[model samples]
Target: MLNMKVGESVNEYFARTLAIVNKLRANKGKIDDVAVIEKILRSMTSKFDYVVHSIEESNDLDALTIDELQSNLLVHEQLMKTHVVEEQALKVTLGESSGERGRGRGGMRG
Candidate 1:
């Protein structure tokens, strides 16, 4: 949702991302599978990595006179979006899996 046009400082985008991630975490209960959940959390890091590399390789940075310290702020923003989307998708998958597990066990106990 934090769609900024050209020349938007990465810092602004990053703050918005952190807000959203916090909101999501606040809503969800402790996930049962820490390993799988951790993998989902890893998406944020991967997104940051991609964004930093992209900006570093961008024409905006390459021709710069200054030693551009690649800010992962905007990268974090993009990563947060990806993380939310993936988290939702995984939740759906887990819900379905839980349903299947119940059916496999012959439904609820009396």
Candidate 2:
């Protein structure tokens, strides 16, 4: 499904979520800490479902801070990005290596 923050980075997603939170606070909305936390946990992309579950199971939603959640997701995002880069590099290396396998074998038969 099309969602904020889906295709966006964790930082970008949190930026959008926090903006809405701030606006609610500014308007004197009675949004409680648990409510805010739940909203964030629920609104995250499917990629973070596991992280969100871990946080929910391990911590008290009433005590978790937005900053903490954002960082948790951000770290995961960075790690996933690093892995993707590494995988791409490996693929390129393998492709080039295969193409050079017969380089010094006296060339193809005439």
Candidate 3:
């Protein structure tokens, strides 16, 4: 069982988990889809908690395949990336605005 890291990307986490699952299968061990799905939900980072909750509340997890869950997560991952980029851009704009004000006051004092 792989534990998800706080800063780990979804792609990395999924790859690690999939590797483990593949190893188990190669060894002829029987794995339940429900158990794997539940493990994934439980192991996800806090950032994904909302997505997990939404999935659990709106869909039948038992009926959802691993591929389906991964696809949903991929969508959220893209959203997260976009949100982060937007936030960084906003911060840069705000920083520049504040910087201009500071420089203007400094020039007047000189």
Candidate 4:
């Protein structure tokens, strides 16, 4: 079991979790926050009090056994897809706003 010092604060634990999440996101070629949820899930019970809350809330570990890791790759893939969707949505919204502003300006004059 992971052990953490008794005086460690929750905020510090969360910060560590965020760092791990960011690292995982970087590995997947995305630089966004979508992976945060999953990272939080993994951080729970991390050999210390900093463990993520998600895992504790679920009360289910049978599904997380090593034998199940391969099957769970699909879940990771879906997470990546979700990140792409969010990134694309942000891009689309920004583009639309820019276009509207351009139209409001009555087009560019030569």
Candidate 5:
């Protein structure tokens, strides 16, 4: 099983894992759907822990298909992207405010 990388997005990790699983299947290896589902859940980054927990609590892992899991993860991925954009905007706003203050202070000293 491919290990999920730090800061790796869900789509990337899912694609990698699915590739591995497909290779194993092609080689005539038997795969357990539940195990794959659990592995995906466990391999997720910490940021996805809450969503994973909610899924585990609300749904049966054995019954959930890979497509279903992917759909749910995609939702969270979008949310994460939105949050990152908001944070970047906030940082830029704060930086501009600080820059204005520094320029004003320089003017006062001159």
Candidate 6:
């Protein structure tokens, strides 16, 4: 199992995995989808622990396709990135004075 390295994008990780799987297939390794899915779920970084757990609990690994798993992870990755950006923007806005602001979406923080 090739563990997803820290800071590695999901697409990159998937590409590397597919490459390895292809090589195995070329040599008649008889690898299967469930095996690949389990390996990926096991090999993800700790940041994905919750998502991995959710996937395992919610889906039948035997029936889940690799594409489906990749799509799920990609969505989670995008959400994570959006959340980080929102947090940083909130920090910056909070750092600025209220009077300097023209318009904002969020209401008063209490």
Winning model by TM-score: 6
The lDDT-based order of candidates, best leading, equals: 6, 5, 3, 2, 1, 4
> TM-scores of the models, in the given order?
0.31, 0.78, 0.82, 0.31, 0.80, 0.86
| Number of the top lDDT candidate | 6
Candidate 1 lDDT by residue in tens digits, 46-109: 4355654655466344243211322435446766779899999999899888765445556558
Candidate 2's residue-wise lDDT over 1-110, tens digit each?
A: 22456578888877777777789888986777777778777878888888889989998877888778777878888988999999999998997888964476678787
Clashing pairs in 6: none
Query: Pairs clashing in candidate 2?
Result: none
Tens digit of per-residue lDDT, candidate 6, span 4-81: 999999999999999999999999968999999999999999999999999999999999999999999999999999
After superposition, candidate 1 runs with Cα above 4 Å error: 1-47, 60-76, 97-110
As for candidate 1, its clashing pairs are: none
1-110, model 5: which lDDT tens digit per residue? 46689888888998899898999888978898888899899988888899999999999887899999999999988998999999999998998887753465346542
What residue pairs are clashing in model 4?
2-47, 2-48, 3-47, 43-52, 44-51, 44-52, 45-51
- The model with the greater lDDT, 3 or 4, is 3
Please give, for residues 1-110, the per-residue lDDT of candidate 4 as tens digits. 22223444444445565566567677876744433444434543333322334334553553353223323433544565698899999998998887653465556677
Model 4 lDDT-worst window of ten: 65-74
Q: Indicate the TM-score of model 3.
A: 0.82
User: How many steric clashes does model 6 contain?
Assistant: 0
Residue 94 error, candidate 6, Å? 0.6
**Candidates 1 and 6: which is better by lDDT?**
6
Estimate candidate 1's alpha-carbon lDDT, on a 0 to 1 scale: 0.49
Off by over 4 Å in 3: 97-110
